[model samples]
Target: MHDVIGLVLAAGAGRRLRPYTDELPKALIPVDGDTTILDIALANLAASDLREVAVVVGYKSNAVEERREALERRHGVRLTLVHNDKAEVWNNAYSLWTAREVMSEGALLVNGDTVHPVSVEQTLLQYRQQEGSEDIVLALDTAKVLAEEEMKVVTDERGHMRRITKLMDPSEASGEYIGATLIEGAAVPALAEALQATFERDPQLYYEDGYQELVNRGGTVGTAPIAAGTSWVEVDDHRDLERARTIACRY
Candidate 1:
Protein backbone atom coordinates (compact mmCIF):
# COMPACT_ATOMS: atom_id res chain seq x y z
CA MET A 1 0.00 0.00 0.00
CA HIS A 2 1.16 3.52 -0.76
CA ASP A 3 1.54 6.27 1.83
CA VAL A 4 -1.64 8.12 1.11
CA ILE A 5 -2.95 11.28 2.74
CA GLY A 6 -6.46 12.72 2.72
CA LEU A 7 -6.72 15.64 0.30
CA VAL A 8 -9.72 17.98 0.25
CA LEU A 9 -10.59 20.79 -2.13
CA ALA A 10 -12.52 23.35 -0.09
CA ALA A 11 -11.58 26.60 -1.72
CA GLY A 12 -14.64 27.35 -3.83
CA ALA A 13 -16.51 30.62 -3.14
CA GLY A 14 -19.84 28.87 -3.84
CA ARG A 15 -21.54 32.07 -4.92
CA ARG A 16 -24.90 30.41 -5.45
CA LEU A 17 -25.03 29.52 -1.75
CA ARG A 18 -24.99 33.16 -0.68
CA PRO A 19 -25.69 34.45 2.88
CA TYR A 20 -24.35 31.17 4.23
CA THR A 21 -21.36 31.69 1.94
CA ASP A 22 -21.20 35.44 2.44
CA GLU A 23 -18.99 35.14 5.49
CA LEU A 24 -17.61 31.64 5.01
CA PRO A 25 -16.69 29.23 2.27
CA LYS A 26 -19.21 26.63 1.16
CA ALA A 27 -17.38 23.90 3.04
CA LEU A 28 -18.11 25.60 6.33
CA ILE A 29 -21.90 25.39 5.99
CA PRO A 30 -23.55 23.34 8.71
CA VAL A 31 -25.60 20.45 7.38
CA ASP A 32 -26.18 18.33 10.49
CA GLY A 33 -26.38 20.11 13.81
CA ASP A 34 -23.04 21.85 14.27
CA THR A 35 -21.11 19.56 11.96
CA THR A 36 -20.15 21.53 8.88
CA ILE A 37 -19.58 19.97 5.47
CA LEU A 38 -15.81 20.05 6.03
CA ASP A 39 -16.29 18.32 9.36
CA ILE A 40 -18.01 15.34 7.72
CA ALA A 41 -15.25 15.22 5.12
CA LEU A 42 -12.51 15.20 7.74
CA ALA A 43 -14.38 12.69 9.86
CA ASN A 44 -14.79 10.32 6.93
CA LEU A 45 -11.11 10.63 6.06
CA ALA A 46 -10.10 10.00 9.65
CA ALA A 47 -12.33 6.95 9.79
CA SER A 48 -10.50 5.64 6.73
CA ASP A 49 -7.29 5.73 8.81
CA LEU A 50 -5.75 8.69 7.04
CA ARG A 51 -4.02 10.57 9.86
CA GLU A 52 -2.52 13.31 7.74
CA VAL A 53 -4.71 15.68 5.73
CA ALA A 54 -4.23 18.60 3.40
CA VAL A 55 -7.10 21.02 2.86
CA VAL A 56 -6.97 23.70 0.17
CA VAL A 57 -8.44 26.91 1.54
CA GLY A 58 -9.46 30.27 0.10
CA TYR A 59 -12.51 32.53 -0.07
CA LYS A 60 -12.35 33.57 3.56
CA SER A 61 -9.51 31.25 4.50
CA ASN A 62 -9.32 32.80 7.96
CA ALA A 63 -12.48 31.03 9.02
CA VAL A 64 -10.83 27.68 8.41
CA GLU A 65 -7.62 28.88 10.01
CA GLU A 66 -9.47 29.87 13.15
CA ARG A 67 -11.05 26.45 13.46
CA ARG A 68 -7.86 24.55 12.58
CA GLU A 69 -6.96 23.52 16.11
CA ALA A 70 -10.48 22.44 16.99
CA LEU A 71 -10.90 20.40 13.82
CA GLU A 72 -7.58 18.63 14.28
CA ARG A 73 -8.42 17.82 17.89
CA ARG A 74 -11.88 16.61 16.95
CA HIS A 75 -10.76 14.42 14.04
CA GLY A 76 -7.40 13.25 15.45
CA VAL A 77 -5.59 14.18 12.27
CA ARG A 78 -2.75 16.56 11.50
CA LEU A 79 -3.80 19.09 8.90
CA THR A 80 -1.69 21.07 6.45
CA LEU A 81 -3.56 24.03 5.01
CA VAL A 82 -2.86 24.66 1.33
CA HIS A 83 -3.82 28.18 0.30
CA ASN A 84 -5.29 28.85 -3.14
CA ASP A 85 -5.02 32.55 -3.81
CA LYS A 86 -6.85 32.13 -7.09
CA ALA A 87 -9.77 30.25 -5.58
CA GLU A 88 -12.04 33.29 -5.70
CA VAL A 89 -11.20 34.16 -9.32
CA TRP A 90 -10.43 30.80 -10.95
CA ASN A 91 -12.21 27.50 -10.67
CA ASN A 92 -11.17 24.28 -8.92
CA ALA A 93 -8.53 23.29 -11.47
CA TYR A 94 -6.14 25.80 -9.94
CA SER A 95 -7.39 24.98 -6.48
CA LEU A 96 -6.48 21.32 -7.03
CA TRP A 97 -3.15 22.29 -8.58
CA THR A 98 -2.27 24.20 -5.42
CA ALA A 99 -2.04 20.93 -3.55
CA ARG A 100 0.26 19.16 -6.05
CA GLU A 101 3.05 18.85 -3.53
CA VAL A 102 0.91 17.11 -0.92
CA MET A 103 -0.70 14.96 -3.61
CA SER A 104 2.67 13.68 -4.80
CA GLU A 105 2.71 11.03 -2.07
CA GLY A 106 -0.76 9.91 -3.27
CA ALA A 107 -4.12 10.99 -1.81
CA LEU A 108 -7.74 10.03 -1.26
CA LEU A 109 -9.30 13.15 -2.73
CA VAL A 110 -12.76 14.41 -1.78
CA ASN A 111 -14.59 17.61 -2.46
CA GLY A 112 -15.10 19.48 0.82
CA ASP A 113 -18.75 20.30 0.11
CA THR A 114 -19.79 16.67 -0.46
CA VAL A 115 -21.47 14.87 2.44
CA HIS A 116 -20.95 11.12 2.17
CA PRO A 117 -20.19 8.18 4.42
CA VAL A 118 -16.79 6.66 5.12
CA SER A 119 -17.81 3.74 2.89
CA VAL A 120 -17.07 5.87 -0.16
CA GLU A 121 -13.44 6.25 0.92
CA GLN A 122 -13.21 2.56 1.81
CA THR A 123 -14.55 1.57 -1.61
CA LEU A 124 -11.94 3.60 -3.49
CA LEU A 125 -9.09 2.29 -1.33
CA GLN A 126 -10.24 -1.32 -1.70
CA TYR A 127 -10.44 -1.02 -5.48
CA ARG A 128 -6.97 0.52 -5.65
CA GLN A 129 -5.46 -2.47 -3.88
CA GLN A 130 -6.79 -4.98 -6.38
CA GLU A 131 -4.73 -6.38 -9.21
CA GLY A 132 -4.75 -4.47 -12.52
CA SER A 133 -6.19 -1.38 -10.84
CA GLU A 134 -5.71 1.91 -12.61
CA ASP A 135 -3.55 4.65 -11.08
CA ILE A 136 -6.62 6.87 -10.68
CA VAL A 137 -9.97 5.55 -9.43
CA LEU A 138 -13.21 7.50 -9.00
CA ALA A 139 -16.20 6.70 -6.78
CA LEU A 140 -19.16 6.70 -9.16
CA ASP A 141 -22.89 6.61 -8.49
CA THR A 142 -24.49 4.49 -11.17
CA ALA A 143 -27.91 4.35 -9.49
CA LYS A 144 -28.52 8.08 -9.38
CA VAL A 145 -30.59 9.86 -11.97
CA LEU A 146 -28.24 12.06 -13.95
CA ALA A 147 -28.84 15.75 -14.52
CA GLU A 148 -27.01 18.62 -16.23
CA GLU A 149 -25.37 19.70 -12.96
CA GLU A 150 -23.86 16.30 -12.25
CA MET A 151 -20.33 15.53 -13.34
CA LYS A 152 -21.19 12.63 -15.62
CA VAL A 153 -18.94 9.80 -16.75
CA VAL A 154 -18.89 7.49 -19.77
CA THR A 155 -16.84 4.33 -19.45
CA ASP A 156 -15.82 1.63 -21.88
CA GLU A 157 -16.64 -2.09 -21.50
CA ARG A 158 -13.55 -2.65 -19.34
CA GLY A 159 -14.66 0.14 -16.96
CA HIS A 160 -11.99 2.60 -17.99
CA MET A 161 -13.38 6.11 -18.26
CA ARG A 162 -13.93 7.26 -21.84
CA ARG A 163 -15.40 10.65 -21.04
CA ILE A 164 -15.77 12.87 -17.95
CA THR A 165 -17.48 16.19 -18.35
CA LYS A 166 -20.57 18.19 -17.39
CA LEU A 167 -21.35 19.08 -21.01
CA MET A 168 -22.37 15.53 -21.96
CA ASP A 169 -25.96 14.40 -22.24
CA PRO A 170 -27.22 12.60 -19.10
CA SER A 171 -28.74 9.76 -21.17
CA GLU A 172 -25.28 8.74 -22.45
CA ALA A 173 -23.60 8.72 -19.05
CA SER A 174 -22.62 5.55 -17.26
CA GLY A 175 -22.70 7.22 -13.84
CA GLU A 176 -22.08 10.41 -11.91
CA TYR A 177 -18.57 11.09 -10.60
CA ILE A 178 -19.37 11.87 -6.99
CA GLY A 179 -16.40 14.15 -6.23
CA ALA A 180 -14.21 11.42 -4.80
CA THR A 181 -11.01 10.07 -6.38
CA LEU A 182 -7.96 8.02 -5.42
CA ILE A 183 -4.81 9.27 -7.06
CA GLU A 184 -1.76 7.01 -6.89
CA GLY A 185 1.72 8.43 -6.38
CA ALA A 186 2.72 7.41 -9.89
CA ALA A 187 0.01 9.61 -11.42
CA VAL A 188 0.90 12.84 -9.60
CA PRO A 189 3.29 14.39 -12.09
CA ALA A 190 1.02 13.82 -15.04
CA LEU A 191 -2.03 14.98 -13.15
CA ALA A 192 -0.27 18.16 -12.03
CA GLU A 193 0.73 18.89 -15.62
CA ALA A 194 -2.77 18.15 -16.84
CA LEU A 195 -4.28 20.47 -14.21
CA GLN A 196 -1.93 23.24 -15.27
CA ALA A 197 -2.96 22.81 -18.88
CA THR A 198 -6.63 22.75 -17.93
CA PHE A 199 -6.46 26.00 -15.95
CA GLU A 200 -4.33 27.73 -18.58
CA ARG A 201 -6.78 26.74 -21.32
CA ASP A 202 -9.57 28.35 -19.37
CA PRO A 203 -9.31 29.80 -15.87
CA GLN A 204 -12.88 28.80 -15.15
CA LEU A 205 -12.39 25.13 -16.11
CA TYR A 206 -13.08 22.45 -13.48
CA TYR A 207 -10.67 19.89 -12.05
CA GLU A 208 -12.74 17.26 -13.87
CA ASP A 209 -11.38 18.81 -17.04
CA GLY A 210 -7.94 17.86 -15.76
CA TYR A 211 -9.20 14.26 -15.62
CA GLN A 212 -10.39 14.62 -19.21
CA GLU A 213 -6.94 15.91 -20.18
CA LEU A 214 -5.41 12.73 -18.78
CA VAL A 215 -7.98 10.60 -20.59
CA ASN A 216 -7.20 12.41 -23.81
CA ARG A 217 -3.56 11.45 -23.23
CA GLY A 218 -4.54 7.76 -23.13
CA GLY A 219 -4.36 7.41 -19.36
CA THR A 220 -6.70 4.84 -17.86
CA VAL A 221 -9.02 6.16 -15.15
CA GLY A 222 -11.02 3.46 -13.37
CA THR A 223 -14.26 3.60 -11.39
CA ALA A 224 -15.83 2.01 -8.30
CA PRO A 225 -19.60 2.17 -8.06
CA ILE A 226 -20.88 3.33 -4.69
CA ALA A 227 -23.19 0.79 -3.09
CA ALA A 228 -26.80 1.20 -4.20
CA GLY A 229 -29.11 3.03 -1.76
CA THR A 230 -26.22 4.70 0.03
CA SER A 231 -27.08 8.27 0.87
CA TRP A 232 -24.93 11.21 -0.24
CA VAL A 233 -25.38 14.80 -1.30
CA GLU A 234 -23.26 17.60 -2.72
CA VAL A 235 -24.62 20.76 -1.12
CA ASP A 236 -24.62 23.50 -3.74
CA ASP A 237 -27.79 25.31 -2.70
CA HIS A 238 -30.30 25.56 0.16
CA ARG A 239 -32.32 22.67 -1.32
CA ASP A 240 -29.20 20.51 -1.49
CA LEU A 241 -28.31 21.59 2.05
CA GLU A 242 -31.70 20.40 3.26
CA ARG A 243 -31.15 17.06 1.49
CA ALA A 244 -27.72 16.80 3.13
CA ARG A 245 -29.23 17.37 6.55
CA THR A 246 -31.66 14.51 5.97
CA ILE A 247 -29.00 12.00 4.87
CA ALA A 248 -25.99 13.13 6.92
CA CYS A 249 -27.51 12.35 10.30
CA ARG A 250 -27.96 8.74 9.20
CA TYR A 251 -24.27 8.46 8.37
Candidate 2:
Protein backbone atom coordinates (compact mmCIF):
# COMPACT_ATOMS: atom_id res chain seq x y z
CA MET A 1 0.00 0.00 0.00
CA HIS A 2 2.15 2.76 -1.13
CA ASP A 3 0.51 5.80 -2.68
CA VAL A 4 -0.78 4.78 -6.09
CA ILE A 5 -3.08 6.38 -8.63
CA GLY A 6 -5.88 4.42 -10.30
CA LEU A 7 -5.95 5.00 -14.06
CA VAL A 8 -8.99 3.95 -16.04
CA LEU A 9 -9.17 3.87 -19.84
CA ALA A 10 -12.83 4.54 -20.57
CA ALA A 11 -12.57 6.14 -23.99
CA GLY A 12 -13.84 3.49 -26.33
CA ALA A 13 -17.15 3.74 -28.16
CA GLY A 14 -17.70 -0.04 -27.97
CA ARG A 15 -19.14 -0.03 -31.45
CA ARG A 16 -19.74 -3.76 -31.42
CA LEU A 17 -22.20 -3.18 -28.59
CA ARG A 18 -24.09 -0.95 -31.06
CA PRO A 19 -27.58 0.04 -29.93
CA TYR A 20 -26.68 -0.34 -26.27
CA THR A 21 -24.02 2.34 -26.84
CA ASP A 22 -26.16 4.47 -29.12
CA GLU A 23 -26.36 7.19 -26.50
CA LEU A 24 -23.89 6.11 -23.84
CA PRO A 25 -20.34 4.81 -23.73
CA LYS A 26 -19.69 1.23 -22.69
CA ALA A 27 -18.46 2.27 -19.22
CA LEU A 28 -21.94 3.66 -18.42
CA ILE A 29 -23.78 0.51 -19.43
CA PRO A 30 -25.58 -1.08 -16.50
CA VAL A 31 -24.53 -4.59 -15.68
CA ASP A 32 -25.54 -5.31 -12.08
CA GLY A 33 -28.64 -3.62 -10.80
CA ASP A 34 -28.09 0.06 -11.72
CA THR A 35 -24.33 0.07 -11.28
CA THR A 36 -22.12 0.77 -14.28
CA ILE A 37 -18.87 -0.88 -15.33
CA LEU A 38 -17.00 2.29 -14.34
CA ASP A 39 -18.80 2.25 -10.99
CA ILE A 40 -17.54 -1.24 -10.29
CA ALA A 41 -14.06 -0.13 -11.34
CA LEU A 42 -14.11 2.88 -9.01
CA ALA A 43 -15.54 0.87 -6.12
CA ASN A 44 -12.87 -1.78 -6.57
CA LEU A 45 -10.09 0.83 -6.65
CA ALA A 46 -11.41 2.58 -3.57
CA ALA A 47 -11.78 -0.70 -1.73
CA SER A 48 -8.18 -1.50 -2.64
CA ASP A 49 -7.14 1.83 -1.05
CA LEU A 50 -6.11 3.51 -4.31
CA ARG A 51 -8.18 6.55 -3.40
CA GLU A 52 -6.80 8.99 -6.00
CA VAL A 53 -7.93 8.21 -9.52
CA ALA A 54 -7.57 9.55 -13.06
CA VAL A 55 -10.00 8.60 -15.79
CA VAL A 56 -9.16 8.99 -19.51
CA VAL A 57 -12.43 9.81 -21.21
CA GLY A 58 -13.81 10.21 -24.73
CA TYR A 59 -16.84 9.12 -26.73
CA LYS A 60 -19.62 10.79 -24.78
CA SER A 61 -17.34 11.87 -21.97
CA ASN A 62 -20.11 14.12 -20.66
CA ALA A 63 -21.86 10.98 -19.53
CA VAL A 64 -19.01 10.27 -17.13
CA GLU A 65 -18.42 13.94 -16.29
CA GLU A 66 -22.08 14.44 -15.37
CA ARG A 67 -21.71 11.93 -12.56
CA ARG A 68 -18.13 12.88 -11.57
CA GLU A 69 -19.02 14.62 -8.35
CA ALA A 70 -21.38 11.87 -7.25
CA LEU A 71 -18.97 9.06 -8.17
CA GLU A 72 -16.16 10.77 -6.27
CA ARG A 73 -18.33 11.18 -3.19
CA ARG A 74 -19.61 7.64 -3.44
CA HIS A 75 -16.16 6.07 -3.97
CA GLY A 76 -14.31 8.29 -1.50
CA VAL A 77 -11.62 9.31 -3.97
CA ARG A 78 -10.40 12.45 -5.71
CA LEU A 79 -11.13 11.96 -9.38
CA THR A 80 -9.26 13.67 -12.22
CA LEU A 81 -10.46 13.73 -15.78
CA VAL A 82 -7.99 13.38 -18.69
CA HIS A 83 -9.42 13.97 -22.13
CA ASN A 84 -8.44 12.10 -25.30
CA ASP A 85 -9.76 14.03 -28.24
CA LYS A 86 -8.85 11.23 -30.65
CA ALA A 87 -10.70 8.56 -28.72
CA GLU A 88 -12.93 7.89 -31.68
CA VAL A 89 -10.16 7.71 -34.27
CA TRP A 90 -7.11 6.62 -32.31
CA ASN A 91 -6.77 3.50 -30.19
CA ASN A 92 -6.21 3.13 -26.46
CA ALA A 93 -2.48 3.69 -26.82
CA TYR A 94 -3.23 7.40 -27.22
CA SER A 95 -5.91 7.23 -24.57
CA LEU A 96 -3.34 5.87 -22.14
CA TRP A 97 -0.65 8.30 -23.24
CA THR A 98 -3.03 11.12 -22.28
CA ALA A 99 -2.54 10.35 -18.59
CA ARG A 100 1.27 10.38 -18.65
CA GLU A 101 1.56 13.24 -16.17
CA VAL A 102 -1.03 12.05 -13.66
CA MET A 103 0.26 8.48 -13.67
CA SER A 104 3.95 9.37 -13.44
CA GLU A 105 3.80 8.85 -9.70
CA GLY A 106 2.65 5.25 -10.25
CA ALA A 107 -0.60 3.73 -11.50
CA LEU A 108 -2.94 0.77 -11.51
CA LEU A 109 -4.75 0.77 -14.85
CA VAL A 110 -7.94 -1.10 -15.61
CA ASN A 111 -9.92 -0.97 -18.80
CA GLY A 112 -13.42 0.42 -18.31
CA ASP A 113 -15.19 -2.41 -20.09
CA THR A 114 -14.13 -5.09 -17.60
CA VAL A 115 -16.07 -6.35 -14.58
CA HIS A 116 -14.26 -8.25 -11.84
CA PRO A 117 -14.11 -8.65 -8.08
CA VAL A 118 -12.06 -6.31 -5.91
CA SER A 119 -9.79 -9.24 -5.17
CA VAL A 120 -8.30 -8.74 -8.62
CA GLU A 121 -7.03 -5.32 -7.56
CA GLN A 122 -5.95 -6.67 -4.17
CA THR A 123 -3.90 -9.42 -5.74
CA LEU A 124 -2.17 -6.95 -8.02
CA LEU A 125 -1.19 -4.67 -5.13
CA GLN A 126 0.11 -7.61 -3.15
CA TYR A 127 2.23 -8.70 -6.07
CA ARG A 128 3.67 -5.22 -6.48
CA GLN A 129 4.95 -5.34 -2.92
CA GLN A 130 6.79 -8.56 -3.47
CA GLU A 131 10.62 -8.50 -3.47
CA GLY A 132 12.48 -8.23 -6.79
CA SER A 133 9.29 -7.06 -8.47
CA GLU A 134 9.21 -4.22 -11.01
CA ASP A 135 6.77 -1.35 -11.60
CA ILE A 136 4.81 -3.13 -14.35
CA VAL A 137 2.59 -6.04 -13.33
CA LEU A 138 -0.21 -7.50 -15.41
CA ALA A 139 -3.19 -9.21 -13.79
CA LEU A 140 -3.44 -12.53 -15.56
CA ASP A 141 -6.26 -15.10 -15.58
CA THR A 142 -4.31 -18.25 -16.10
CA ALA A 143 -6.93 -20.56 -14.69
CA LYS A 144 -9.73 -19.49 -16.98
CA VAL A 145 -10.62 -21.00 -20.32
CA LEU A 146 -9.11 -18.97 -23.16
CA ALA A 147 -11.04 -17.54 -26.10
CA GLU A 148 -10.28 -15.51 -29.20
CA GLU A 149 -11.89 -12.31 -27.93
CA GLU A 150 -9.83 -12.03 -24.75
CA MET A 151 -6.52 -10.14 -24.67
CA LYS A 152 -4.03 -13.02 -24.66
CA VAL A 153 -0.63 -13.05 -22.96
CA VAL A 154 2.49 -15.17 -23.16
CA THR A 155 5.16 -15.27 -20.48
CA ASP A 156 8.64 -16.68 -20.22
CA GLU A 157 9.66 -19.43 -17.80
CA ARG A 158 10.63 -16.75 -15.27
CA GLY A 159 7.07 -15.27 -15.55
CA HIS A 160 7.88 -11.98 -17.28
CA MET A 161 5.34 -11.13 -19.94
CA ARG A 162 6.72 -11.92 -23.41
CA ARG A 163 3.66 -10.96 -25.38
CA ILE A 164 0.30 -9.26 -24.74
CA THR A 165 -2.20 -8.96 -27.56
CA LYS A 166 -5.41 -10.47 -28.95
CA LEU A 167 -3.78 -11.26 -32.27
CA MET A 168 -1.75 -14.15 -30.87
CA ASP A 169 -2.95 -17.72 -31.24
CA PRO A 170 -4.96 -18.91 -28.24
CA SER A 171 -2.91 -22.07 -28.09
CA GLU A 172 0.26 -19.99 -27.92
CA ALA A 173 -0.94 -17.85 -25.03
CA SER A 174 -0.09 -18.53 -21.42
CA GLY A 175 -3.12 -16.61 -20.13
CA GLU A 176 -5.48 -13.68 -20.60
CA TYR A 177 -4.42 -10.17 -19.39
CA ILE A 178 -7.92 -9.24 -18.07
CA GLY A 179 -7.11 -5.49 -18.49
CA ALA A 180 -5.70 -4.80 -15.01
CA THR A 181 -2.06 -3.76 -14.60
CA LEU A 182 0.29 -2.02 -12.21
CA ILE A 183 2.37 0.47 -14.17
CA GLU A 184 5.14 1.40 -11.75
CA GLY A 185 6.97 4.72 -11.72
CA ALA A 186 10.08 3.22 -13.29
CA ALA A 187 7.95 2.12 -16.21
CA VAL A 188 6.55 5.59 -16.87
CA PRO A 189 8.99 6.82 -19.51
CA ALA A 190 9.29 3.54 -21.34
CA LEU A 191 5.54 3.14 -21.35
CA ALA A 192 5.06 6.69 -22.57
CA GLU A 193 7.55 6.23 -25.36
CA ALA A 194 5.99 2.91 -26.32
CA LEU A 195 2.48 4.30 -26.28
CA GLN A 196 3.58 7.26 -28.40
CA ALA A 197 5.25 4.97 -30.89
CA THR A 198 2.24 2.71 -30.99
CA PHE A 199 -0.14 5.56 -31.71
CA GLU A 200 2.20 7.14 -34.24
CA ARG A 201 2.55 3.85 -36.10
CA ASP A 202 -1.20 3.52 -36.29
CA PRO A 203 -4.03 5.16 -34.41
CA GLN A 204 -5.74 1.79 -33.99
CA LEU A 205 -3.05 0.24 -31.78
CA TYR A 206 -4.01 -1.09 -28.35
CA TYR A 207 -2.27 0.11 -25.18
CA GLU A 208 -1.04 -3.43 -24.68
CA ASP A 209 1.26 -2.71 -27.58
CA GLY A 210 2.86 -0.14 -25.30
CA TYR A 211 3.70 -2.91 -22.88
CA GLN A 212 5.34 -4.76 -25.72
CA GLU A 213 7.37 -1.62 -26.42
CA LEU A 214 8.59 -1.53 -22.85
CA VAL A 215 9.66 -5.13 -23.23
CA ASN A 216 11.55 -4.36 -26.41
CA ARG A 217 13.45 -1.72 -24.46
CA GLY A 218 14.37 -4.43 -21.95
CA GLY A 219 11.77 -3.50 -19.32
CA THR A 220 10.51 -6.24 -17.04
CA VAL A 221 6.73 -6.49 -16.73
CA GLY A 222 5.51 -9.04 -14.17
CA THR A 223 2.25 -10.96 -14.19
CA ALA A 224 -0.02 -11.55 -11.21
CA PRO A 225 -2.20 -14.58 -11.75
CA ILE A 226 -5.71 -14.34 -10.35
CA ALA A 227 -6.72 -17.04 -7.90
CA ALA A 228 -8.90 -19.95 -8.83
CA GLY A 229 -12.70 -19.40 -8.74
CA THR A 230 -12.26 -15.65 -9.28
CA SER A 231 -14.71 -14.53 -11.96
CA TRP A 232 -14.47 -11.61 -14.46
CA VAL A 233 -15.73 -10.58 -17.86
CA GLU A 234 -14.83 -7.93 -20.49
CA VAL A 235 -18.01 -6.70 -22.16
CA ASP A 236 -17.47 -6.06 -25.85
CA ASP A 237 -20.72 -7.28 -27.38
CA HIS A 238 -24.26 -8.29 -26.46
CA ARG A 239 -23.25 -11.81 -25.41
CA ASP A 240 -20.39 -10.49 -23.30
CA LEU A 241 -22.70 -7.91 -21.75
CA GLU A 242 -25.06 -10.70 -20.76
CA ARG A 243 -22.22 -12.57 -19.12
CA ALA A 244 -21.19 -9.43 -17.26
CA ARG A 245 -24.71 -9.04 -15.91
CA THR A 246 -24.84 -12.68 -14.89
CA ILE A 247 -21.58 -12.56 -12.95
CA ALA A 248 -21.88 -8.97 -11.73
CA CYS A 249 -24.93 -9.51 -9.54
CA ARG A 250 -23.10 -12.38 -7.86
CA TYR A 251 -20.33 -9.96 -6.84
Clashing pairs in 2: 135-184
* Residue pairs clashing, model 1: none
What would the per-residue lDDT of candidate 2 be over residues 12-90, giving only the tens digit for each residue? 9999998979889999999988899999999999999899999999999999999999999988989999999999888
CA lDDT of 41 in candidate 1? 96
**In model 2, which regions exceed 4 Å deviation?**
none
When superposed on Cα atoms, how far off is each prediction in RMSD? 0.7, 1.1
lDDT, candidate 1, 207-248, per-residue tens: 999999999987879999999987999988889989999998
Candidate 1 local lDDT, residue 56:
99
lDDT of 2 at 174: 92
TM-score of each: 0.99, 0.97
Q: After aligning candidate 1 to the native by TM-score, how far in Å is the CA of 151 from where it should be? A: 0.5
Per-model CA lDDT versus the true structure: 0.94, 0.91
Q: Candidate 2 vs. truth: CA RMSD?
A: 1.1
